[model samples]
Target: MAANSRFSIAVHVLTMLAKNCDGRVKSDFIAESVNTNPVVIRRLLCSLQEANLVVSQVGASGGTCLARQPKKITLSEIYNAVSHGEIFSPHPKTPNQDCPVGKNIEAILCRLQKEIDKTVEQKLAQYTLQNVIEMVEREKV
Candidate 1:
């Protein structure tokens, strides 16, 4: 299955906004940077806006900007804003309760998935958008 890109895109959006030297950046510009459609960036922008991670403006000079400082925006907050559902999807149909392996598999995987999700959340909380920007600064040529 294709991995969901919402989280990564959300971070990219925020990072761009943090470095938004011009104050606000347009979706079209952000989309160009991400090499995806503007609508995709706009859609993700909605979620980030809802989470208060970013703000938008309208009209001739309209665009988007970060709602909080880079240091205050945690990766966990970004992940929570864009993420929905479990890390690992469950079976489409109910597992064969009649079969020993099928009966126990989904539940087993779900337990592990929860553990992983929690761990990921905790780790993400330890970092912030400022951390990403600093790394980017160091990597710049």
Candidate 2:
């Protein structure tokens, strides 16, 4: 399956907003920085806004800004806002029942996937948007 970039893009957008919290940022500028189309950026922004992570305005001077302070937003919130699929998807077809491994593989994988998901959620919760902004600043040497 193709890897999804929604989570990454959402985090990037949030980090940019946190790093430059002076005023609203145009989606065009954000698109240029992300190397993607403005429409894509706008779509992601809409999702963020729905999640209460961002707020947007209209008109010539209108743009987007974070709804809350960077320190108040967690990576877990962004992940849940944009992520659409299982971290580990099951096989498309059912495994053969004759083989013991095949018969039990799905159950094993399902349990493992649940454990991984829990761990990832815990890790993501430990990170805030402020942490990401600080990391980005450190890389600017």
Candidate 3:
């Protein structure tokens, strides 16, 4: 199961905010760092806001800031924010239902997908943005 780039992008945004320590960081700066479009960043910001992972302020000095402390924000939390649908999307094409294996394949695949999602989320929950920052800082030469 492949996850979207939103997870990494969100981590980037949060880590940048953590370093700044200020109330907010503009989305454009974030977009530049992530090498993505400002419009994409804004859309992601909206989702993060809805998840309470981040908040937006309007006006000249307006931008986005973490809703909670970096140490408190888990990667899983970030994953949940921008992830809209299933973590593992099912096969788009329908399989033939005449065969026994074919009829039950979807059910078995779904069960496996759920298990994978749970395990992945559990692992992600162990790391917060603070941990990521520490790793990044340690890697600096």
User: Where does candidate 2 have its weakest 10-residue lDDT segment?
Assistant: 80-89
lDDT of 2 at 67: 96
Candidate with better lDDT, 1 vs 3: 1
RMSD of 2: 2.4
lDDT of 2 by residue, 1-141 (tens): 487899999999888888668999999989988999999999999999989999999899999999999999999899988885368789999999999999999999999998888888889999999998888889988
TM-score versus the correct structure, for each prediction: 0.86, 0.84, 0.88
Point out where model 1 deviates above 4 Å. Answer: 99-104
Cα misplacement distance, residue 119 of candidate 1 (Å): 0.6
Cα lDDT, all candidates: 0.91, 0.90, 0.85
Candidate 3 clashing pairs?
none
lDDT (10s digit) by residue, model 1, range 36-134 = 999999999999999999889988889999988899999999999999647778899998899999999988998998898999999999999999999
Decoy 3 TM-score against native: 0.88
Model 2 clash pairs are: none
lDDT of the structure predicted as candidate 3? 0.85
